[model samples]
Target: MSRGTDPYVAGAMDRRIALAHEWDELVERVRRLGPRFASFLAPPRTQDFLSAVGDGTAVLINVARECHALLVTASGVTAVPLPGLSAAEIADRTERHLTALRRTDLAAQRVHHTQQRARVRKVPATYQAHHAAKIEMAEAQAELDRTLLPQLAWLWDTVAEPVLRALGSPARAGAEAGHRIWWCPTGLLSFLPLHAAGYHDGSGRTVLDRAVSSCVPTLRALARAARAPETEPAETDKLLVVAVQEADGMSPLPQVDEELRLLEDMFGPDRLTVLEGPNATREAVLGQLPQHRWAHFSCHGRQDPLAPSTGGLLLTDGVLGIKELGARAYNGDFAFLSACMTAAGGLSLSDEAITVGAALHYSGFRHVVAALWSIDADTATALTGDVFGSLTRGGRFRPQASAAAVTEAVIRLRNDSPAHPSRWAAFTHIGP
Candidate 1:
């Protein structure tokens, strides 16, 4: 019935915006109070410190209160499930987000040479305790959305409108080949890992496949790359194919096979091969990993707390665990993990394990393309096809351009008729 599965997500966002407004007001008020410990103590530092003078006092307390209010309001309302991420997952994301915020604060200090340290006391006092508490609240908020929204699909059914779907965007002209992009597509999932086999086991079939035709054009485009009369993708040590999947489930091999067939049509079936069953073991995947120049998979990939290496996508044989694989060391040509959450790098300050896409990059692949957030399969199908289409249609076979093509398409869709930004902005391009 509701457009958003979790009202808390919107509420949390609105609260954060309101808090930002409050932060500005506090900064303004403090300025009227005159300089901190007044002196000719660097006019700029004084101004900067004054601007954030009460932030230390206000932000933490207010944020904590907001969390408390969320818990209460959520219980009283329509009982809309809150979309939340796990603690570590939340930390990974929020920490990175906060790190940016922290950096912004730090940058101001750079201009004010007199202020050698943080204006927010930088002490581990009760005030700092509250700050930590604030972080916990935000993390919880993220986790709530991460956990609930996926499981409760009906929450957004009415929200999906077809008004903007009719207008297709203009195609970009010319060839721009700078970066390599490896694309992973999710057929359809509702909290199911696209790559993991569990999807097939439990669910009958995804409605997403029929929503749009992703297999034909997307595969043809990549196959065209394989058929390139000139230019070959550089290979350092081996070919890195980053197969993306959800945090848990079976590999998305069967669905990938259909597209693999499409690839064979262009590249010829003999040159193309598909691995299955017990042969899909990690060892087998690894053995094949170093040999192939190009590889593609459809699955789910995750980036979470604890360690980056532990984060991995679901595969046919158990989860294709990344922690054990250690992607940074692999040297490959190009790989695409057509799964959700593959683009995520280390959240916060921590250097996460090779994210689905990053792992390919670190694994020595020249180019990697991954999505930033959980994308709907139907949306992914259309987006991935357009991206590969750009390359197949005479554009440079670079990941950067391909990925940008996707974003541009969504932008075009939005500009033609403003649909939800979340529908398109969810996808992101990663790597050099």
Candidate 2:
């Protein structure tokens, strides 16, 4: 009964050898089909394909209760496991943070209203009530901090630190200047701010500190975008700048004019097509989209939680829903959605990839810069101007330089307004 020539073991080994050969043949066929077609085929879970992507970038895919950090470099890929980080927990924390943020915004508004009332002529009877309300708001905020800080710390420990460690701690001393990461989060994790996840333990351990963070819906999307054709130079490229300062019943954004003016100056008047107020209608903007290589939207954006695909940019006539964009094929390469919730997704349908930014990507824009929440008008203008300026300096346009340029611009804004995450962290680059 010696096992030296066991028939069962020998047969199993032969089958495995044959399967290996079959797999190699399949892979070779996919390679000949091209990157776009090969993307549809599931890649092997091993590190063999990492060489096909860019250097110094890692792609983290979060799923269910764990994260798979695929460290991609010019040489190879390495998978790092991040366990015990459940999607449910991430979602709960995100919702809690958003609630706290809304409460903080309301408190600020109340304080401003009280100040306006005081300026007019405060009544003695109402003064005591207003002061009491302010105190109550402060106490509520303190309570919220007690709940929020711990969750953020947990995320840093469980999620961000592991990913950074896998990427060889790009934040460490003497690391190269342009380290980048593309986060492809699942479920509610997509809505959470992965870039800002860190504890406030006096140690700068945040993702923003470590690397420039960008997002893509899938690894396939990132690969596709990386291979997309380059846009024409700014001098020759056509840009469609749409600003809906007043759209029906929505609040007007007068600062959009400033954003448009800055963009016009950079792109030059002949290269720019300006659409504002009544002219920035749904049909008009959609019609003009195919003719331009770039588009900048400075208007209100809405997210429909009930039907996520219905969410879109609010134009003068109506909403330019994702459904409409899906029907068209445009030649645009970049889209800057300077609007509220352009990157936000419905909690229930978080995996649908239906945000305005995603829609623009589907509509053939290789790169999209969008907001995760409502942004301050002045902050948006400043950030956009700096980003585009960095891109077009020396009269040369470099689309490949966008990620680093955006990170630099946001860091500058963060330095100026350190306490306000709403101003800096809200905007995110959503593609290559």
| Cα lDDT, model 2, residue 96 | 83
Least accurate 10 contiguous residues by lDDT in model 2: 170-179
* CA lDDT of every candidate: 0.39, 0.73
Off by over 4 Å in 2: 1-52, 65-67, 72-77, 101-153, 172-178, 199-202, 231-236
Cα lDDT tens digits for candidate 1, 307-339: 456666666566666655554354444455666
Tens-digit per-residue lDDT, 1-432, candidate 2:
357878998888889999999998887788678765564456544343353356656565556545666667767767778786766677678778667656755674565566556657768756765686588667655655565556556767877788777667755421125357777777777776676566544466666666777877766667657667775464427779999887664556767989988988887878889888899988899888888878889998887555777788998889988889778887667788889888887767887767888888876888888887667779999988998998889975555677777777877776685445566777788777
Model 2 TM? 0.78
Candidate 2, lDDT over the whole model = 0.73
What TM-score do all the candidates reach, one by one?
0.42, 0.78
Which regions of candidate 1 are displaced past 4 Å? Answer: 1-266, 276-279, 324-331, 345-354, 394-418
